[model samples]
Target: MEDWKKLYENPPETGVLFYNETVMDHFRRPRNVGEIPDADGVALVGDPRCGDHIKLYIKVKDDRITELRYKVFGCAAAIATTSILSELAIGRRIEEALEITDDEVIKAAGGIPSGKAHCSLLGVVGLHYAISDYLRKKGEATSGDKR
Candidate 1:
């Protein structure tokens, strides 16, 4: 596999070859890159196939996402996606945050490589899981719990 060897030897500097400037920026200095103690909602999700994992924390107040934080264990795209997702979710209603889509996250990060698009989807799914956990703790039916 000479081609594979060459590719590995010349890997992209930012870890993702086609990552735009925004993605590189976020990957280098991710926003909300931590855990929130006493968070209102917390979720941990992973893609076993790709070995990517994301942990999202949210603080909700009066049905609004007052704060957000995240930890990502993956490539540059994963970090950037979660970073942008945090920004989009904060200061918005929980329902609005839930509406944040993978495409929106990718676009906000200036677009990730097509091969890394799943990372953005992971960010969205992580948020959904966190929101569902919060609603459950509040004794409310989550979207999936509804008949």
Candidate 2:
């Protein structure tokens, strides 16, 4: 009990944020950071608390996402998460791509600090919105729209 208390009181040396090598690599040179002209679906989403915005573009071919790209204005966490999300989503089927989540993005980015968890949300939200747009344009029902 005393040891636990002491450990809790005198925690490890940590700063405000923690960014591992993978996170820094993605942040410094993010992947698929651009717009796809004539994109099949496009979506823009933002986080009010962080003032982070992302515009995701997708090109679908034969029910699969042939390409994925995005433009993000945010901190290092947001950028890194989004970059990883794009890489995971591209070349995936619509259903599989739609399943992409913030957790996966964070894991791929080497796990961001809990304080910056919302940064991962920005990317997954953007991807979902774009997929919704694509489904709507195809006259298919989205998970929410299938009422």
- Please name the candidate that would achieve the greatest lDDT relative to the true structure: 2
lDDT of 2 by residue, 30-137 (tens): 999999999989999998887999999999999999999899998999899999998999899999988888988887887787899999998898899999999887
- Against the hidden true structure, what lDDT does model 1 obtain? 0.88
**lDDT (tens digit, per residue) of candidate 1 on 1-147:** 998888777876664556678988888999998999998889999999899999999898999999889889998889988998988899999889888999899878876777888999999999999999898877754444454
Error of 2 at 88 (Å): 0.5
Question: Measured by TM-score, how close is model 1 to the native structure?
Answer: 0.83
lDDT of each: 0.88, 0.88
Candidate 1, which ten residues in sequence have the lowest lDDT sum? 138-147
- Which parts of model 1 are misplaced by more than 4 Å? 1-17, 140-147
* Index of the highest-TM-score prediction: 2
lDDT of 2: 0.88
Error of 1 at 117 (Å): 0.4
